[model samples]
Target: MFDGPSSRREFMKAAVAVGGASALSACMSRAEEPIPKGTDDPSSLPERQHAWNDVLVHDDAGNVEGPRHQLLLYVNLDHDGPPTEDDRRVLESALTTLDRAYERSHEGLVYSIAYSPAYFDRFDESLPDDLDLPEPRSLAPFEDPEFDRQDALLHLGSTRADALLEAEEALTGDRDTANTVTMESPLTDVLAVDSRRTGFVGAGMPAERQDVAGIPDSKPVPEQSPLFMGFKAGFAQNQATEDYVTLQDGPFAGGTTKHVANIRQRLDDWYVEQDFEDRVAEMFSPRHAAEGLVDGVGDNLGDSSGLTPDIIESIEEQAKQYGRVGHAQKAARANRDEEGNVRVLRRHFESTDDDVASLHFPSLQTGISVFEEVREAMNGTDLTSNPAIRQRVNNGILEYIFVRRRGNFLVPPRRLRSFPTPTGE
Candidate 1:
């Protein structure tokens, strides 16, 4: 099934989407070089599991580039109620095997394990009042989304498709060895895999896989665009530092809260009806389109999205003037604090899972409330006061995207990652 008339990149993307032992074998056979081995001492690694930016590669413009391929494994505990200490040890051993099997970088593997609110509910004690994790719910009035209540979410990412597949197989006990390292324990020993979702990001990746649903038949996705929307994102200045998002004072200090959402895109109208200028106007701002500030895929903008405080404050005026407001422009309103520090770290990627164009959006912040505030800002419902902008139409990209699922998790620090209790016992 992996064989066809497709580019090497496309072939790898398909292999990841259709993951299994056969897919791993096919990916390994096509690998051009040996996968890098990881460290013997996992203790030296950073305490924060989300610390991937330092080791990840950056573009010529200095923006951090995400892994080429990524997967999210939502799993449930094998048994009921609270897990035993033996369960923690077994899970930790499985994760340690991965650390020993692959280097902690994009070329090897960058991953994290987070527990959901439901996972902590099994305990008698409640999470500290300071922790802002809450049950997942629909954030906008126009959408109804399913909430993911899985016990845990295991995120695995790598530049090499073979590495990503191998790591996953090893964890699920499908393979005893990962990158030639014998697995002492597999995650499946204590957890049952519930759902698996896959995605990718980077230049040429979106264009290569645009033949799926949601995208138009014209293949209007730019060759250099990292996303199907035909633009670059995750600007350095626009993102919060890992330290900023880490829990500063708690038993789970050095950890963070994560909110993951899956949004389906229907872009037939986005590409067919809107021209480049109109897209720029809606994606950035009307002023950006007027000033000709953004270039192809926005690589020329460097470390920032070119959104000024004035532009963010003028969204109502822009909507009144141009009859449209930009997606980034609206989100920027609540993405910053009084000190002007970005409040959330967005690590979203494009997907062709189930032969449909979608996005796996994972956002990290000090608390889940921060993410909700940002999403509310992105909803652009406040701007709907104007007759020109309704709830979905002309209100950012809401018209082209639909929120299908939402989930909130607490990404405990490395030490507390394995079935952590509410009070971080």
Candidate 2:
């Protein structure tokens, strides 16, 4: 079904979204070059599982570029209660096989495994007092999103479609080996995959897949936009450094908390009713639209969104005057700490899973409360006092985006990634 006149990248994206053994075989047949091999020494890898910036490619503007294709495997422990040492060894062997099979880079494979609060509850001991992992819940009053209480979340990302598919097959026991590396064990020996989601992010990717349901038939997604919203995001200046989000003094000190949300996008009104200027106003800030600060897909902004403190401070006045505030503007109010450091690192990607337009949002921070605080600011509940800004209508992109699912997890240090206990056994 992915066959057509589409570019190779586009075809690979389609294959990933419709993943299976057949898709993997077709992807392998289309490979133009051999994938880079991984290291035999697992000790050489970063201690933090979320560490990927050093090896990832960056744009000319110095902004970090995420992998082209991504996959999420939400799995549950095959048996109830705490896991046994044998289970831990089985999972570790399966993961280490992946480490030896593929290079830990965007061109190869960069992945992380995180445990949910539900998974830790099975253990008698509780998490460290300093750690702040929490159960997922709705952040806003208007939305009712399903909570993901799975035992663990395994995130895999790579530029090569075949690499992602082969790694997944190896973990699920579908294949005996990945990249010619024999698998000592498969993850299914200890855990069963409860859900699988796929997504992509890169220039020209969103435009090629705009035929989905939530997007309008006009195909208004920009060819240069990495996201379906026709704009660039993840500005380096606006993002928190990995060190800031990592737990500094706990057993999981080298780790961090991750809040993952699946958001469904309805772009009919976003693209159909609004023009370029209107979108710029709602996406960035009204001042940006008036001063012509943003260009096509916002590549001209460089490493920043150009949201100055004054622009963020004038949100109320802008709402009263322009009758609209921006998505970035509202979120910026609480994104910064008292010392002016960014609080969360957002690693979001667009998706066409289930033939619908959606986004897989992964945010890393020191704690789940920090993410909740930033999300509350994004909700723009306080901005409703301006009368022009209702809960969703003129408050930002809320009108076009709906939260579908939310989950929180503790990304332990690499040493404890395999079915770790709450106390880091």
lDDT of 1 by residue, 1-425 (tens): 44554656667877899999987897898898999999999688999999999989898778899998999999999989899999999998999999999999999999999999999998889999989999999999989999999999999999999999999999999999999999988999999999999999999999999999999999999999999999999999999999899999989999999999999999998999998888898898898998999999999999999999999998888898999999999999999999999999999999999899999999999999999999999999989899999999888889999999999999999988888889888
Q: Report the error of model 1 at residue 393, Å.
A: 1.0
Clash-forming residue pairs, model 2: none
What digit string (tens of lDDT, one per residue) describes model 2 on residues 1-425?
45564666666776788878888888898887888999999889999999988878899888998898999999999998799999999999999999999999988899999999999999999998878998999999999999999999999999889999999998999889899999879999999999999999989899999999899999899999999999989999999998899888868889999999999999999999999999999999999999999999999999999999999999999998899999999999999999999999999999988899999999999999999999999999999988888999888899999999999999999999998888886
**Candidate 1 error regions (>4 Å):** 1-6
* CA-only RMSD, every prediction: 1.4, 1.3
